[model samples]
Every structure is written in structure tokens, then in C-alpha cells.
Target: MSLSSKVRTLKELPLYLPRRFSAAQRQRNRRNAARPPAQGIVVGLLAQVCGRLVKAGEEALRIPERLPPSAQRVQEELKSRGYPHRVVETEETTRSAEEAARAVGCGVGQIVKSLVFRGRDSGRPILILASGANRVDVAKIGKLAGEPVEKPDAKFVREHTGFAIGGVPPVGHPERLQTYIDEDLMRYGEVWAAGGTPNHVFRLAPNELADMTGGKVAVTK
Candidate 1:
């Protein structure tokens, strides 16, 4: 099975099992659990990547407890990186850049959307970070890639990134996928992105994020 398939199977197994936990089961789970909650490994890994790239320390801000759906994990990862973050609790869901901007009171251009596409070569996934105000120019992307760039469906996105489409982060694929960052994001000194989970988010400079992800800087949209 593909890596995406395996992760899907693992994520789905819980649905077939009971929700209640026995003492032994809980104990076993605790023994294997990692700190700061392992449910958001992708978010955690994003922070690790940021740490490696920034070297001088980066800011990772967490959202409030009652904040949107995908910024929670982002908050944790940001805190881990020593970034000063404010948690703004709101009713808006951060599923899109517009919504995230509204919830955080930022400009639409400042919302960084992590996008995933099926690479033209090897058929593996590639990640793109684009400004909220723009749409991806696929032909341009194809030329840069030297291969055709195709949009993957919802199932394909979840399978490859281990996160739903609306909550895709720049880092933390089951495998390291090729990443491209939009040049437009450079306009803002700081921008926000999903934290791996729907209820979390984090902010960073675009150049800093590019460095952290080792992402190619391009006009993605």
C-alpha cells in the first residue's frame, strides 16, 4: 500500500473500535504518547523544521482554546519555537485564507495557504505555499517543475499530507514532499499558516518559512 493509504487505514481504525478505554489500554497509550500531544505530528515537525532553519529562534503563536478549527496545533508548534503568539478566539473557521484573516484581523494577503499537488515526476506530492489573494498558475508551475502539475482530489491530499486540504501545513508530510513557496508571501513581514490541526496556526516571515522548508521561491499563483 502507498504511504497515504497506510496512514488512512491507521487513522480510520479508531472508527471501527470502541471509544471507551480500559485502564490497561489507557496506561499503554500513555506509555507510548509523546509530549504536547502527538495528534499533530505534522505541526510538531513544522516547528522542528523552522527551528533548524531559523537557528536564531522563531516565533510560533498559538490560538485560543475556542479559536478556529486548524490553528491549535500551529500555536503549540510556534510556542515550541519561542515565537510570541496571540490566541484570538473567534467563531470563524480557518479553513480558508479569508476566514483566517477575518478571525485574526489580518489582511487576506497575509494568510499563507499551504497547498499540495501531485508532482509531475514520480507522482509524489509537492507542497506549495501561496498568498490568499492569488490563485496558482498551474502552467507556470509545470514549467518550473519541468513536468505537468495536477491538482489532487480531497482523498489524495489527505493521503499525502496526512491532513485535510483546508488544514495543510508547509511541513510534516509522512515523507518529505517537494515544496514551493509563493513569492507573493514575501510582501508581508509576517504571515499565518495552519499548524497541522484545524484549530491551530502559526506566524512567521515568508523568507524564514522558505528557509525552514527548504522551499523553492517562485511565483506560485
Candidate 2:
């Protein structure tokens, strides 16, 4: 099937993945992706939220077949959401903000990192969309959520969000984790987010993206 025709829901990821992934890791990720989606309302209900707002014209980021699981997952999620995307694969994983920006030829500030944190009291997760140039002040973010927010461990991220660290998208979590968008991201005309995977990213307009995710935009130091 063509890339466009093959993808359905966020669950249909195998159709887009490459045939040769590291045997051990590939098997593990496939299992995780196939599991039933955990019960939780997709926070925002805007139509074509990802595609309509994040991708535009010739600037769309392509999803490569050999991308890391996180990047691959992001591509499929965006595609499922109706966004046109292309995955840019790299020889090595772009696990950090600097590497992701370098791979896409953008400034560190333009990279939009999809971060997950656990609220101390509510036990609900918080997804923070912050600019690469900025750091998420845990105290400030925690205050916004009306609780102390702590970053969940890798196991917690996967268990709660379904997707692992590098691949978590801004939306599509098991629960509608309280979300925040840094005002700094809006300063750029375009921002890049993990395609659901670390190796891939999709460009988005900050304002429209905030609308799509239903995240309150705030200042983060």
C-alpha cells in the first residue's frame, strides 16, 4: 500500500515501518504499539489538528522508513491526524534538542520538545510543549497544574502515554494530561515536535498548535 493509503489510526504503525529494525528493539516496540490504546479522552477535539496546523507547503518534514521507533510513531500519528509529513532519518538518533534542531536545520529555539511530567497530587501526567531554547522550570509548570510536577521515568512515560520518551506527541496520551505551551515557541513562525519518535519531527505554527492541543500557553524560564 502507498504510504498515504496504508496508515489508518495511530495503531497502524507497522505498515509504515521498515522491514529491518534491530531484532530485539524492533520486536519490543511492535508489541507495545499493538497493545490496546489505554482508555482516556483525547483532550482537544479540533479537526485535522496536527496536519492542518503543523505542516504547510514545501516545508513539510518527511518521515523516513528507517527512522527510530519514536520518530516513526510520530509520523504515523501525524498522518493519522491528516497532516502531510516526511520523516528525516539520521545516521544516529537525535535524542537531544540540539541534535533534533541540527538535523532539521533550525535554531535550537525553534525545536518544540514534547515533554511529560507527573503531577504529585493528582497523579495525572502533564505534557509540556517548550521551546528548545528554554528549560521547563518544574516549579512553574507544577504551579500551573496546581500540583508539583515531576518527570516520569521511562517506564511511566510508556505506561501512561503509550509511546516512549523520544516519540511522545503533543496529543494522544492515555489520559488528557494537563498540557502547557511555552510562549517562547510562539515567537517562531514554525516549530518542530517529535513525530512521536526522536528521529522524526513535524513543523507547526505555535498559535494553531496550542489550539490543536488545548494547552494553556505560558512563560517557562
Worst-scoring 10-residue span by lDDT in model 2? 42-51
For all candidates in order, the CA lDDT equals 0.52, 0.54
lDDT of 1 by residue, 20-85 (tens): 334565444434421221111121111111111221111122223354444455455455656554
Best by TM-score: 2
**Which sections of candidate 2 miss by over 4 Å?**
1-80, 86-92
Best lDDT among the predictions, by candidate number: 2
- Residue-level lDDT tens digits of model 2 in 187-212: 66555455555544455557757866
Q: What's each prediction's clash count?
A: 16, 14
Candidate 1, residue 25: the lDDT equals 50
TM-scores of all candidate predictions against the true structure: 0.60, 0.63
Model 2 residue 115 lDDT? 71
